[model samples]
Target: MTDAAPSPDIAVLLADDHDLMRESFRALLDASPGFRTAGEAGTGAEAIRLAREYRPDVVLMDVRMPEMDGIEATRRICADPDLSGVQVLILTTFDLDEYVYAALTAGASGFLVKDSTATELLNGIRLVAAGEALLAPRVTRRLIATFTGKGQPAGSPRGLDEITEREQEVLVLIASGLSNTEIAQELNVALGTVKTHIGRLLNKLDARDRAQLVIAAYDSGLVTPRSR
Candidate 1:
Protein backbone atom coordinates (compact mmCIF):
# COMPACT_ATOMS: atom_id res chain seq x y z
CA MET A 1 0.00 0.00 0.00
CA THR A 2 1.12 3.55 -0.61
CA ASP A 3 2.28 5.55 2.43
CA ALA A 4 0.30 8.54 3.59
CA ALA A 5 1.51 11.87 2.23
CA PRO A 6 3.83 13.93 4.37
CA SER A 7 2.74 17.33 5.60
CA PRO A 8 4.10 20.17 3.55
CA ASP A 9 6.78 22.35 5.10
CA ILE A 10 5.80 25.88 6.13
CA ALA A 11 7.43 28.13 3.53
CA VAL A 12 9.11 31.26 4.94
CA LEU A 13 10.70 34.35 3.40
CA LEU A 14 13.40 36.07 5.45
CA ALA A 15 13.55 39.84 4.83
CA ASP A 16 16.34 41.78 6.47
CA ASP A 17 18.79 44.35 5.14
CA HIS A 18 21.71 42.42 6.60
CA ASP A 19 22.95 39.37 4.74
CA LEU A 20 24.21 37.84 7.99
CA MET A 21 20.78 37.90 9.62
CA ARG A 22 19.12 36.29 6.62
CA GLU A 23 21.76 33.60 6.41
CA SER A 24 21.48 32.91 10.14
CA PHE A 25 17.68 32.58 9.98
CA ARG A 26 17.80 30.46 6.86
CA ALA A 27 20.21 28.12 8.59
CA LEU A 28 17.97 27.80 11.61
CA LEU A 29 14.85 27.15 9.53
CA ASP A 30 16.68 24.67 7.30
CA ALA A 31 17.85 22.70 10.32
CA SER A 32 14.36 22.59 11.83
CA PRO A 33 11.54 20.27 10.89
CA GLY A 34 8.28 21.46 9.31
CA PHE A 35 9.96 24.53 7.81
CA ARG A 36 11.57 25.62 4.53
CA THR A 37 13.21 28.89 3.57
CA ALA A 38 11.47 30.07 0.42
CA GLY A 39 13.70 33.06 -0.33
CA GLU A 40 15.47 36.14 1.05
CA ALA A 41 15.33 39.88 0.40
CA GLY A 42 17.66 42.73 1.38
CA THR A 43 15.27 45.62 0.92
CA GLY A 44 11.59 46.21 1.58
CA ALA A 45 10.98 46.65 -2.15
CA GLU A 46 12.72 43.40 -2.88
CA ALA A 47 10.74 41.77 -0.11
CA ILE A 48 7.55 42.85 -1.83
CA ARG A 49 8.72 41.46 -5.13
CA LEU A 50 9.79 38.16 -3.59
CA ALA A 51 6.55 37.91 -1.66
CA ARG A 52 4.67 38.04 -4.94
CA GLU A 53 7.03 35.54 -6.47
CA TYR A 54 7.11 32.98 -3.64
CA ARG A 55 3.81 33.50 -1.83
CA PRO A 56 5.34 32.13 1.38
CA ASP A 57 3.36 31.30 4.50
CA VAL A 58 5.21 33.92 6.58
CA VAL A 59 7.56 36.85 6.02
CA LEU A 60 10.10 37.68 8.77
CA MET A 61 10.35 41.44 8.21
CA ASP A 62 13.01 43.76 9.61
CA VAL A 63 11.60 47.23 10.33
CA ARG A 64 14.48 49.33 9.05
CA MET A 65 15.43 48.91 5.40
CA PRO A 66 17.34 50.97 2.83
CA GLU A 67 14.62 52.05 0.37
CA MET A 68 11.16 51.50 1.70
CA ASP A 69 10.67 50.51 5.38
CA GLY A 70 9.45 47.15 6.62
CA ILE A 71 6.22 48.75 7.81
CA GLU A 72 5.40 49.95 4.29
CA ALA A 73 6.29 46.57 2.87
CA THR A 74 4.04 44.92 5.41
CA ARG A 75 1.22 47.28 4.52
CA ARG A 76 1.56 46.49 0.83
CA ILE A 77 1.72 42.76 1.37
CA CYS A 78 -1.28 42.73 3.70
CA ALA A 79 -3.24 44.93 1.37
CA ASP A 80 -2.70 42.67 -1.59
CA PRO A 81 -5.74 40.54 -2.35
CA ASP A 82 -3.62 37.87 -4.02
CA LEU A 83 -1.33 37.49 -0.98
CA SER A 84 -4.01 37.10 1.63
CA GLY A 85 -2.47 33.89 2.90
CA VAL A 86 0.87 35.53 3.68
CA GLN A 87 1.56 36.80 7.19
CA VAL A 88 4.43 39.12 8.18
CA LEU A 89 6.32 38.80 11.49
CA ILE A 90 8.39 41.83 12.39
CA LEU A 91 11.95 41.48 13.78
CA THR A 92 13.54 44.24 15.78
CA THR A 93 16.49 44.88 18.12
CA PHE A 94 14.48 45.57 21.26
CA ASP A 95 11.95 43.48 23.13
CA LEU A 96 9.65 45.65 21.07
CA ASP A 97 10.90 48.42 18.81
CA GLU A 98 9.00 51.63 19.40
CA TYR A 99 7.95 51.22 15.75
CA VAL A 100 6.98 47.60 16.28
CA TYR A 101 3.61 48.82 17.39
CA ALA A 102 3.30 50.67 14.10
CA ALA A 103 4.26 47.51 12.26
CA LEU A 104 1.37 45.74 13.94
CA THR A 105 -0.91 48.54 12.79
CA ALA A 106 0.48 48.05 9.31
CA GLY A 107 -0.83 44.46 9.35
CA ALA A 108 2.01 42.34 10.72
CA SER A 109 0.84 39.25 12.59
CA GLY A 110 3.30 39.92 15.45
CA PHE A 111 7.01 40.38 16.18
CA LEU A 112 10.20 38.86 17.59
CA VAL A 113 13.30 40.44 19.01
CA LYS A 114 16.54 39.90 17.08
CA ASP A 115 17.94 37.98 20.07
CA SER A 116 14.99 35.61 20.45
CA THR A 117 15.79 31.99 21.14
CA ALA A 118 15.56 29.67 18.16
CA THR A 119 12.60 27.93 19.72
CA GLU A 120 10.71 31.19 20.09
CA LEU A 121 11.30 32.16 16.45
CA LEU A 122 10.29 28.74 15.15
CA ASN A 123 7.16 28.65 17.26
CA GLY A 124 6.23 32.16 16.18
CA ILE A 125 6.45 31.11 12.53
CA ARG A 126 4.28 28.07 13.18
CA LEU A 127 1.68 30.06 15.06
CA VAL A 128 1.39 32.65 12.31
CA ALA A 129 1.32 30.02 9.57
CA ALA A 130 -1.48 28.23 11.40
CA GLY A 131 -3.49 31.49 11.41
CA GLU A 132 -3.07 32.05 15.15
CA ALA A 133 -1.84 35.45 16.24
CA LEU A 134 1.65 35.59 17.81
CA LEU A 135 0.77 38.21 20.37
CA ALA A 136 2.15 37.39 23.80
CA PRO A 137 1.45 39.44 26.92
CA ARG A 138 4.65 41.41 26.53
CA VAL A 139 3.78 42.35 22.94
CA THR A 140 0.35 43.44 24.03
CA ARG A 141 1.85 45.53 26.82
CA ARG A 142 4.16 47.25 24.38
CA LEU A 143 1.27 48.11 22.10
CA ILE A 144 -0.74 49.51 24.99
CA ALA A 145 2.12 51.60 26.29
CA THR A 146 2.52 53.28 22.92
CA PHE A 147 -1.00 54.03 21.66
CA THR A 148 -3.50 53.92 24.49
CA GLY A 149 -3.84 57.60 25.42
CA LYS A 150 -3.70 59.60 22.24
CA GLY A 151 -7.39 60.45 22.65
CA GLN A 152 -8.36 58.75 19.41
CA PRO A 153 -12.13 58.47 19.41
CA ALA A 154 -13.76 55.09 19.74
CA GLY A 155 -15.29 53.15 16.81
CA SER A 156 -12.39 53.93 14.50
CA PRO A 157 -12.86 50.80 12.41
CA ARG A 158 -16.20 51.84 10.81
CA GLY A 159 -18.51 49.08 12.14
CA LEU A 160 -18.23 49.41 15.89
CA ASP A 161 -21.82 50.46 16.32
CA GLU A 162 -22.98 47.15 14.89
CA ILE A 163 -21.30 44.99 17.53
CA THR A 164 -23.41 43.72 20.40
CA GLU A 165 -22.66 44.83 23.94
CA ARG A 166 -21.31 41.36 24.81
CA GLU A 167 -18.92 41.50 21.86
CA GLN A 168 -17.67 44.84 23.07
CA GLU A 169 -16.98 43.32 26.47
CA VAL A 170 -15.06 40.49 24.87
CA LEU A 171 -13.02 42.99 22.82
CA VAL A 172 -12.17 44.95 25.96
CA LEU A 173 -11.06 41.78 27.70
CA ILE A 174 -8.98 40.83 24.67
CA ALA A 175 -7.22 44.21 24.71
CA SER A 176 -6.57 43.63 28.41
CA GLY A 177 -4.58 40.52 27.36
CA LEU A 178 -7.08 37.84 28.40
CA SER A 179 -6.89 34.52 26.62
CA ASN A 180 -10.00 32.72 25.39
CA THR A 181 -10.07 30.43 28.42
CA GLU A 182 -9.63 33.39 30.73
CA ILE A 183 -12.38 35.32 28.99
CA ALA A 184 -14.68 32.31 29.20
CA GLN A 185 -14.04 31.94 32.92
CA GLU A 186 -14.44 35.66 33.54
CA LEU A 187 -17.71 35.84 31.63
CA ASN A 188 -18.98 32.51 33.01
CA VAL A 189 -19.69 31.38 29.47
CA ALA A 190 -18.66 28.27 27.58
CA LEU A 191 -15.35 28.51 25.72
CA GLY A 192 -17.19 27.90 22.47
CA THR A 193 -19.34 30.91 23.21
CA VAL A 194 -16.27 33.10 23.59
CA LYS A 195 -14.85 31.81 20.33
CA THR A 196 -18.11 32.53 18.57
CA HIS A 197 -18.10 36.09 19.88
CA ILE A 198 -14.54 36.62 18.74
CA GLY A 199 -15.38 35.27 15.31
CA ARG A 200 -18.18 37.75 15.02
CA LEU A 201 -15.94 40.53 16.24
CA LEU A 202 -13.37 39.67 13.59
CA ASN A 203 -15.99 39.80 10.87
CA LYS A 204 -17.50 43.07 12.07
CA LEU A 205 -14.19 44.80 12.61
CA ASP A 206 -12.65 43.48 9.37
CA ALA A 207 -9.59 42.41 11.33
CA ARG A 208 -7.47 39.46 10.29
CA ASP A 209 -6.36 38.37 13.79
CA ARG A 210 -6.54 39.01 17.51
CA ALA A 211 -3.63 41.46 17.35
CA GLN A 212 -5.71 43.75 15.16
CA LEU A 213 -8.64 43.29 17.52
CA VAL A 214 -6.52 44.58 20.37
CA ILE A 215 -5.64 47.64 18.31
CA ALA A 216 -9.29 48.16 17.50
CA ALA A 217 -10.24 48.05 21.15
CA TYR A 218 -7.74 50.79 21.93
CA ASP A 219 -8.50 52.88 18.84
CA SER A 220 -12.16 52.76 19.71
CA GLY A 221 -11.46 53.88 23.25
CA LEU A 222 -13.21 50.72 24.44
CA VAL A 223 -10.17 49.74 26.47
CA THR A 224 -7.44 52.17 27.41
CA PRO A 225 -4.04 51.60 29.02
CA ARG A 226 -5.20 53.62 32.00
CA SER A 227 -8.30 51.44 32.25
CA ARG A 228 -6.46 48.17 31.92
Candidate 2:
Protein backbone atom coordinates (compact mmCIF):
# COMPACT_ATOMS: atom_id res chain seq x y z
CA MET A 1 0.00 0.00 0.00
CA THR A 2 1.15 3.56 -0.65
CA ASP A 3 2.31 5.52 2.37
CA ALA A 4 0.22 8.45 3.56
CA ALA A 5 1.55 11.99 3.42
CA PRO A 6 3.33 13.24 6.48
CA SER A 7 1.50 15.81 8.54
CA PRO A 8 2.94 19.32 8.58
CA ASP A 9 4.36 20.37 11.94
CA ILE A 10 5.29 23.89 13.09
CA ALA A 11 8.29 23.84 15.38
CA VAL A 12 7.98 26.29 18.30
CA LEU A 13 10.39 27.55 20.96
CA LEU A 14 8.82 28.80 24.18
CA ALA A 15 10.74 31.56 26.04
CA ASP A 16 9.39 32.75 29.35
CA ASP A 17 10.69 33.03 32.94
CA HIS A 18 7.65 31.73 34.78
CA ASP A 19 7.56 27.98 35.15
CA LEU A 20 3.81 27.77 35.54
CA MET A 21 3.16 29.94 32.52
CA ARG A 22 5.66 28.03 30.42
CA GLU A 23 4.13 24.73 31.50
CA SER A 24 0.63 25.92 30.69
CA PHE A 25 1.68 27.11 27.27
CA ARG A 26 3.54 23.90 26.62
CA ALA A 27 0.50 21.85 27.51
CA LEU A 28 -1.76 23.87 25.26
CA LEU A 29 0.61 23.89 22.30
CA ASP A 30 1.50 20.24 22.64
CA ALA A 31 -2.13 19.18 22.82
CA SER A 32 -2.90 21.12 19.66
CA PRO A 33 -2.47 19.51 16.28
CA GLY A 34 0.16 20.75 13.78
CA PHE A 35 2.21 22.30 16.58
CA ARG A 36 5.16 20.66 18.31
CA THR A 37 7.26 22.04 21.13
CA ALA A 38 10.79 22.04 19.82
CA GLY A 39 12.35 23.38 23.01
CA GLU A 40 11.86 25.62 26.07
CA ALA A 41 13.90 28.32 27.81
CA GLY A 42 13.55 30.02 31.16
CA THR A 43 15.66 33.02 30.25
CA GLY A 44 16.42 35.18 27.26
CA ALA A 45 19.97 33.85 27.02
CA GLU A 46 18.69 30.33 27.00
CA ALA A 47 16.09 31.26 24.41
CA ILE A 48 18.79 32.59 22.11
CA ARG A 49 20.90 29.46 22.53
CA LEU A 50 18.00 27.10 21.95
CA ALA A 51 16.86 29.15 18.97
CA ARG A 52 20.29 28.86 17.36
CA GLU A 53 20.32 25.16 17.97
CA TYR A 54 16.75 24.35 16.93
CA ARG A 55 16.08 27.20 14.49
CA PRO A 56 12.37 26.87 15.23
CA ASP A 57 9.71 28.17 12.87
CA VAL A 58 8.26 30.42 15.59
CA VAL A 59 9.56 31.72 18.92
CA LEU A 60 6.96 32.57 21.58
CA MET A 61 9.10 35.18 23.34
CA ASP A 62 8.18 36.91 26.58
CA VAL A 63 8.95 40.63 26.65
CA ARG A 64 10.38 40.43 30.13
CA MET A 65 13.03 37.83 30.83
CA PRO A 66 16.31 37.56 32.71
CA GLU A 67 19.69 38.35 31.08
CA MET A 68 18.44 39.47 27.64
CA ASP A 69 14.76 40.33 27.45
CA GLY A 70 12.66 39.48 24.41
CA ILE A 71 13.38 42.70 22.50
CA GLU A 72 17.15 42.23 22.40
CA ALA A 73 16.83 38.54 21.70
CA THR A 74 14.48 39.25 18.83
CA ARG A 75 16.90 41.79 17.39
CA ARG A 76 19.73 39.31 17.57
CA ILE A 77 17.69 36.52 16.02
CA CYS A 78 16.56 38.70 13.13
CA ALA A 79 20.08 39.97 12.62
CA ASP A 80 21.39 36.47 12.09
CA PRO A 81 21.61 35.56 8.43
CA ASP A 82 21.12 31.88 9.16
CA LEU A 83 17.87 32.47 11.08
CA SER A 84 16.12 34.48 8.39
CA GLY A 85 13.16 32.10 8.24
CA VAL A 86 12.56 32.31 11.99
CA GLN A 87 9.67 34.52 13.18
CA VAL A 88 9.45 35.98 16.69
CA LEU A 89 6.06 36.50 18.39
CA ILE A 90 6.23 38.69 21.47
CA LEU A 91 4.13 37.86 24.53
CA THR A 92 3.23 40.48 27.11
CA THR A 93 0.64 40.97 29.83
CA PHE A 94 -0.38 44.48 28.80
CA ASP A 95 -1.82 45.31 25.42
CA LEU A 96 -0.69 48.95 25.55
CA ASP A 97 2.75 48.31 26.97
CA GLU A 98 5.38 50.63 25.45
CA TYR A 99 7.65 47.70 24.77
CA VAL A 100 5.24 46.25 22.22
CA TYR A 101 6.15 48.82 19.59
CA ALA A 102 9.84 48.48 20.36
CA ALA A 103 9.60 44.73 19.99
CA LEU A 104 8.01 45.19 16.57
CA THR A 105 10.81 47.59 15.62
CA ALA A 106 13.25 44.95 16.79
CA GLY A 107 11.79 42.62 14.14
CA ALA A 108 9.03 40.74 15.97
CA SER A 109 6.31 39.44 13.66
CA GLY A 110 3.61 40.38 16.22
CA PHE A 111 2.61 40.59 19.89
CA LEU A 112 0.00 38.80 21.99
CA VAL A 113 -1.35 39.65 25.41
CA LYS A 114 -1.13 36.85 27.94
CA ASP A 115 -4.89 37.00 28.52
CA SER A 116 -5.79 36.22 24.92
CA THR A 117 -8.12 33.29 24.42
CA ALA A 118 -6.69 29.91 23.49
CA THR A 119 -8.03 30.23 19.97
CA GLU A 120 -6.46 33.68 19.55
CA LEU A 121 -3.10 32.46 20.78
CA LEU A 122 -3.07 29.37 18.59
CA ASN A 123 -4.23 31.26 15.50
CA GLY A 124 -1.55 33.90 16.18
CA ILE A 125 1.19 31.32 16.20
CA ARG A 126 -0.17 29.76 13.03
CA LEU A 127 -0.33 33.13 11.29
CA VAL A 128 3.23 34.12 12.20
CA ALA A 129 4.51 30.68 11.26
CA ALA A 130 2.97 31.13 7.83
CA GLY A 131 5.00 34.36 7.31
CA GLU A 132 2.13 36.75 8.08
CA ALA A 133 2.02 39.81 10.35
CA LEU A 134 -0.80 39.53 12.90
CA LEU A 135 -1.65 43.17 13.50
CA ALA A 136 -5.31 44.17 13.33
CA PRO A 137 -6.57 47.64 12.35
CA ARG A 138 -7.09 48.67 15.96
CA VAL A 139 -3.63 47.52 16.87
CA THR A 140 -2.22 49.46 13.95
CA ARG A 141 -3.96 52.61 15.12
CA ARG A 142 -2.57 52.15 18.60
CA LEU A 143 0.93 51.71 17.23
CA ILE A 144 0.65 54.80 15.10
CA ALA A 145 -0.61 56.77 18.06
CA THR A 146 2.23 55.49 20.19
CA PHE A 147 4.79 56.54 17.61
CA THR A 148 3.37 60.02 17.18
CA GLY A 149 2.88 60.50 20.91
CA LYS A 150 6.56 59.86 21.44
CA GLY A 151 7.40 62.44 18.74
CA GLN A 152 9.71 60.02 17.08
CA PRO A 153 11.32 61.37 13.94
CA ALA A 154 9.82 60.14 10.72
CA GLY A 155 11.74 57.48 8.85
CA SER A 156 13.54 58.15 5.58
CA PRO A 157 11.77 57.19 2.38
CA ARG A 158 14.94 56.43 0.45
CA GLY A 159 13.95 52.93 -0.67
CA LEU A 160 10.33 53.75 -1.46
CA ASP A 161 11.18 55.67 -4.60
CA GLU A 162 11.69 52.36 -6.40
CA ILE A 163 8.02 51.37 -6.36
CA THR A 164 5.44 52.50 -8.89
CA GLU A 165 2.88 55.20 -8.00
CA ARG A 166 0.03 52.70 -7.62
CA GLU A 167 2.17 50.56 -5.33
CA GLN A 168 2.87 53.70 -3.30
CA GLU A 169 -0.86 54.21 -2.84
CA VAL A 170 -1.25 50.63 -1.68
CA LEU A 171 1.56 51.10 0.84
CA VAL A 172 -0.09 54.20 2.22
CA LEU A 173 -3.40 52.34 2.56
CA ILE A 174 -1.65 49.47 4.30
CA ALA A 175 -0.10 51.90 6.72
CA SER A 176 -3.53 53.43 7.21
CA GLY A 177 -4.66 50.04 8.57
CA LEU A 178 -6.49 48.75 5.52
CA SER A 179 -6.44 45.06 4.81
CA ASN A 180 -6.01 43.61 1.32
CA THR A 181 -9.76 43.22 0.86
CA GLU A 182 -10.44 46.71 2.15
CA ILE A 183 -7.76 48.22 -0.04
CA ALA A 184 -9.17 46.34 -3.04
CA GLN A 185 -12.64 47.67 -2.42
CA GLU A 186 -11.46 51.20 -1.80
CA LEU A 187 -9.22 51.25 -4.87
CA ASN A 188 -11.86 49.49 -7.00
CA VAL A 189 -9.33 46.85 -7.98
CA ALA A 190 -9.29 43.07 -7.90
CA LEU A 191 -8.22 41.39 -4.68
CA GLY A 192 -5.48 39.70 -6.65
CA THR A 193 -4.26 43.08 -7.80
CA VAL A 194 -4.09 44.33 -4.25
CA LYS A 195 -2.12 41.28 -3.24
CA THR A 196 0.20 41.83 -6.17
CA HIS A 197 0.80 45.42 -5.13
CA ILE A 198 1.50 44.41 -1.56
CA GLY A 199 3.85 41.68 -2.69
CA ARG A 200 5.78 44.11 -4.81
CA LEU A 201 5.89 46.63 -1.99
CA LEU A 202 7.38 44.00 0.28
CA ASN A 203 10.03 43.20 -2.29
CA LYS A 204 10.89 46.77 -3.19
CA LEU A 205 10.99 47.95 0.41
CA ASP A 206 12.82 44.82 1.61
CA ALA A 207 10.19 44.40 4.30
CA ARG A 208 9.57 41.05 5.91
CA ASP A 209 5.79 41.39 6.24
CA ARG A 210 2.88 43.81 6.43
CA ALA A 211 3.84 45.03 9.87
CA GLN A 212 7.20 46.15 8.54
CA LEU A 213 5.46 47.73 5.60
CA VAL A 214 3.35 49.80 7.97
CA ILE A 215 6.45 50.86 9.82
CA ALA A 216 8.07 51.81 6.57
CA ALA A 217 5.10 53.92 5.56
CA TYR A 218 5.24 55.90 8.78
CA ASP A 219 9.01 56.15 8.69
CA SER A 220 8.94 57.29 5.10
CA GLY A 221 6.44 60.01 5.92
CA LEU A 222 4.06 58.55 3.34
CA VAL A 223 1.42 58.05 6.03
CA THR A 224 1.54 60.24 9.13
CA PRO A 225 -0.48 60.14 12.31
CA ARG A 226 -1.52 63.76 11.68
CA SER A 227 -3.05 62.72 8.37
CA ARG A 228 -5.12 59.93 9.87
**Per-residue alpha-carbon lDDT of candidate 1 for residues 1-228, written as tens digits (9 for 90 to 100):** 999999999999999999988999999999999999999999999999999999999999999999999999999999999999999999887644667877888899988888889999999999999987787677577668765667656557877889999999999888887889999999999999999999999999989998899888887777778776
Off by over 4 Å in 1: 1-4
For model 2, residues 132-193, the per-residue Cα lDDT tens digits are 98786876677687664356556665568789999988988888888889999999999999
Displacement of the residue 76 alpha carbon in candidate 2, Å: 0.3
TM-scores of all models? Answer: 0.92, 0.91
What lDDT does the true structure give each of the candidates? 0.89, 0.86
Candidate that scores best on lDDT? 1
How does model 2 fare in lDDT?
0.86
